[model samples]
Target: MRLIIAEKHSVGQAIAQAVGGHMEKHDGYVQVGDDLVTWAQGHLVDLAAPDEYKDHDWDRWSLDTLPIDPTPDWQWKVSRDKGADRQYKVVAGLMRRGDVDMLVDACDPDREGEAIFRRIVKHAGVSKPMRRLWVASLEEDAIRDALASMKDETEYQGLADSAMIRAKADWLIGMNASRAYSLVYNARFTVGRVQTPTLAMIVDRDRQIAGHVARPYWKVVAPMGGWKLAGERLDKREDAETLLRIVNSDDFAFSIFKAERKQQHDAPPRLYDLTGLQKDMSRLHGLTAARTLSALQSLYEKKLATYPRTDSQYITHDDLDTLRGLTEGDRLAAGFIEPDAKPERPHLELTVNDAKVAGHTAILPTMQADKAALDELGDDERLVLTRVVRRMWEAVGDDYVHDVTNVVANIDPHWCEKHPDEGRLLPEGECRFTSRSDQPVSLGWHAIEHAAPQEDHGEEDEAAGNIIPANLAAGVSIAPVPHGGATLSEGKTKPPKPFTEATLLAAMEHASRWVEDKDLKAALDDDESHSGGIGTPATRADVIEKLIRTGYVERKGKQLRSTEQGRSLIDVVAPKLKDVAVF
Candidate 1:
């Protein structure tokens, strides 16, 4: 008999169905014809926690165990997740069967996936010849294809080694730092390769904001037609009042302002990776990053989208044909050519870069989706799938076209002088100018309607307002109309915003530059090094949520702020241990 072990029950069931395995209900196993199929609920076993050691008085948190290194003899235990013990018993029983010939690791094709299978098999003491079933999508056809092309487990030894190192490193840091800080600071403080730096980032931002001091500033305003033309004034309010008097005193002649048209192309947005999806969901629908991830996971399980926990926003050459076919008849597909459309010279430039992608391809629609099926999904799940489907169409769609225009006008002092109090303008000697742009054109992907803005907006909206219009040539003049007492604006130069889940994810993705050391960033970016700047996609969210739950980080509304307990922990931990580079 051949034994197949899957990372989770759903995947195992999918593979069993694809491989012509007849399902039968058994005590601890799913008897699939001659194959004994068993599943792990994520991880069936994990390294025992510090309190579980039960040996020394060190069960309580203390700084003495600064770095809890897991020795070769370190104990392991079954995970506390319900059904883990039963699943393990089933797997062990299947392994003990006399007719079993070999074992198949039909897990998700990633590092953590590799760790899940290895830990289970090692704990179960199974020594059978092992083959790996590495497939990206859970589609039945994909599973069958993977089973037909199974590779020897030895081929993934490096991946397994890397996964083991990551798990052990997390265990070392989380256990030691958590205990050390909890004891010293008298707070439940947890830290890890990913979480500590993220918390530190939030704390630093809060400090910068607290130290910021506001300064008063003045601006000139000219109302022309229905639009208001605004410009900044010097620091002195007296200077602005004098200018306002002069402009109001005269009626300025209007000249035709310069008008020039230029074509601009905005490439359609790249396909969604987990982080990108999370950011969009947060910005558009007020979905928390964790909530968005949950919806994406559901979509993946339903086969509506590709794997959702991936970091890559580009697909390989092999997936191009399927991608093209999936979007062929859709409304957005009218402008996009299929991959085979240009057969001899495929235009794969859209998502074909080999250097950028790893583990899995971008989030995309699987061939299994139908418009009617989407109606059955919950609101959040439907929203996530809609994003995936829209992104797929947009990725290959035409570039967004825009006609940008910059209009600048000189302020007339006489007009300002005529309505001194009404027109808040700079003095005649002070330089003044105003600029405006026509409404933006939405040519392609930008045409997709996003949800209307919520009543409560944030800094992101202010930043979006700062997009500059096209350049304006000098010497354009326009008529100035009386301004009705617009209040001058003032603000302090603000510090960076604290890391919301959205921003923290961005920081992790770009963690290479967190350290000023050039060599460290280079090493992290290099493909040869096992540790990328960010933690693995599968574990990054967990790391973040853990920090929040353990009081190392606190979420205030949408902002993530670090606690005093979190700061003290960082000060105590070895610098390298807190850095993501150590991973």
Candidate 2:
């Protein structure tokens, strides 16, 4: 008999179905064939809190307990999750059974996933033969594939080590800093590896906004028939007024300046990764990051989409055939017609780059998805899945096309005779104009539309327009218009916007920028060796939520802001921990 331990109940059930195990209800597991399918509801055990140690001095918060480093003899406590204690006992009982030959840690394929299994097994004192059942998706096919190709547990020792380091570092920081700050300021505060840096980003942005100052400037405008020409005045408003007086002399003659036209292309957008999907859902549908993730996970469970919690924007070469099948006969493939002679080779390159991927491939649609099944999903879930399917089709489809044009003019000084003080220089019919056209071109992947009003912009402007009008050589001239009005507008500089979950996630992923060692920062991004970065995708969201719950950070609309207590805690920490280094 083999005991398969899963990260959660849903995952265990999926694995059991894949392995063709019979259903027998035990206290905390479902028996199938010779396998005992059981799961941990996240984590069955966590480090004991200070007060749980039964020390009166540690019962109340104090700065004196500055750095509470737990020794090997430190106690472990059962997790507070509703049914964890019972679940742990069930797992232990299975491990102790004489017939069980080996144990399988079938958790999510990430660092935290390793931590979940290791903690449970360590606490249960099970030393049986062990292996890892690493599957990127919860789909039965994916699970079966993983089981058939199971790797030895030792293969992931580095991952386990990294996971342990992250957990201990977080424990050290969160326990010590939280207690220290809460005691000093008489407020509840929490800090950790990911959350503290995140809070610092928000506080800094707030300070930048508070300190910003505004200045005034002016510009000059000339109108010619249907077109308008504008130029900035020197820094002083008086200089602009003086120029207006000179140009109003009625003897000034305008000369042809310059005209140029250039062709431009806007490629279609890249496929969605977890962060990209979250940002799009938030911007388009007003869904929170947590809600978007939940919907995506549901889509994956139903076998309609690939893995959801991924950072990679590229797929493996092995997935090409599956991708090709999705693009054939799909509703999203409607407008694309395969070439008659040799279907133009699909542009699989954009989604197939091997070097940039980490952990798993980009979020995509599985070939098994049925369009009719969409009716069974809730409104938001259906919307998000539809987006995923559409993106997959677009990624492999043709590029978008566009053409551009530019026009320029020169005006006579006599045009400004009536407005000496206003800087209005062009008369009704005294301006020369020129026009030119550049060739039309394709924008590649950026042309594929992801949502309705296909050309809509996202919050961060990842693919904002950069089209330049066609150029007409410097001396070209055309018909001119007689008169136009000129006016100056005034505005002040604004502060940086607060961190949204989307922006904050990006900051955390790039947190190594704050480190000083180039080598350490490089190592942080070395996915093949380390676990990508400081926190795994499965744990980052929880880290963020913990920060909010502990009052170290607060949400203002969609933006995150650091509270007063959070700011003071950073000041109290040693400079090495707080400073932004290259590592």
Candidate 3:
């Protein structure tokens, strides 16, 4: 008999259903025709704590036990999380079953999933022939297909090695640095490889906002008949007045030196990876990353969505047919699409890039979503499901088309040279003004976005020049209007906005942008898995939550700011410890 171990109970249940047997359910496991299926509650086994090592007295948090390196002699312990130990025993017992000859690692298809299965096997001291069950969806067909074409567990040894190395590295850094800092400061301080750098980013941004100095400037705004022309910025009010006067003067001759309009097409957005979904949820729904993840996880278990922890934003060519099916029929009408809504012919291939999709495809609504009573889902789940479903249609929708017009007018050189303030405020050359406008021809994919509910960020309106007259032709003479012409608009340069959850997630995902060392930045860029980031899409939200839980970062409304303690921690940590490139 073969034993299949899954990452969670729901996954194991789904696998058992796909396996198709009598399905005799037991405590912590299920009995299929000729196989046993079980699960681990997250990490059933973890790194042994420092105090657990018999070779050292590291239990007493002291500076002497500074570098807690359990190198070649690393130890493992069962997790104390509720029910983890019990579940581990059940899985271990099944592994040693007399009839079982082979084991299947049916964990989530990712690096962390590999680590979870390996740790459980090692801690249980079981060495049976193993196979890997890798699938992105929990749907019956997907699971059965993955089961029939399993690969030898040894084929994934390299992935397992990398996972182990990352776990140990995190342990070493977190244990030693957290203890050393806590001892010196006489307080409990928790440090992590990725979490520290993440905190540093927040602290740095806060400092920038606190120390920022605003500068004032002025611009000349002239109201044409149906358009507005903006002049170059001037440092002094006198200079602005001189240019404003030149444009408004009776002798001033206004003529369009250039006017051009070009058609542009904006492609639809790519599908959501986990981080992208979390970011959008945080922005539009005011949901935290953890909350978004939890809701998605629930949806995945219910077989309404595909995998929720993936980082890839693309679907493989193999999923093209599935994508096509989703766009047709009543699949999206469950709760998101209106009956009268006429979606465009979806360009299904737009999001298909096999090379970009790694272990799993981007999150998609399962066909089951169509039959599910989505209204019964929790508010958060419904909100996320709606977003996912809407994005499904939008991802394959038509491109947005718009006509952009740019116009530039030059002030007659004779008038500039003849002005009273000739060489003073006015430059030697001809004074020029510019205008731009965009006329959207097709809403396209944006139509779907517009149909969904959006959070009012209270964003300011577009500049006046964004809608100038399209009829203005090159070399056309113009006369300035009476009121609101030649207006001197004073503005102040604003400081950087505080980090919202959405922006912070973006920063963490693209951490290489924060690195100064070229070599290190290049290395990060070349990393295929992380793609120049400190944490995976799976762990970043947790890191942020940990910082908040520890009182290091505080959330004021939607903005995240480092508290006094958080800033002080960043200040005290050594440069190497907080460096983004190093981690």
Cα lDDT, all candidates: 0.68, 0.66, 0.84
TM-score of each: 0.84, 0.82, 0.94
For model 1, residues 1-583, the per-residue Cα lDDT tens digits are 8899887777777777877855896765587778877788888889888778777545655566556665776777898888888788887778777899899988778888898888888888878899999877778888888889999999999889988877787787777766776677676666676777766666667777777675555665555545544555457777655554544435552232454556678886788888888877776676777788888877777767778877788888878787767755553223222322222321345866556677688888787776666778898987877777767666665666776554545454354456555455433335454444444565555555323354344422222222333343444445554434333434333456667777777777667867777888888777445354676666667777888788778888877787877777777766776665654
Residues 295-322, candidate 2, lDDT per residue (tens digit)?
A: 9888877777877878787788887776
What is the Cα root-mean-square deviation between model 2 and the actual structure?
A: 5.5
lDDT of 1: 0.68
Query: RMSD for each model, in Å, please?
Result: 5.4, 5.5, 2.3
Best by lDDT: 3
Residue 411 in model 3: shift from native, Å? 2.7
Superior by TM-score: candidate 2 or candidate 3 = 3
**Please, what are the lDDT tens digits per residue for candidate 3 over residues 332-416?**
8645865444365778888898887778889998877863558779999998988898888878888889888888887755555
Q: In TM-score terms, which candidate is top?
A: 3
For model 1, what is the alpha-carbon lDDT of residue 85? 81
Q: Name the candidate, 1 or 2, with the larger lDDT value.
A: 1
Compared with the true structure, the alpha-carbon lDDT of candidate 2 equals: 0.66
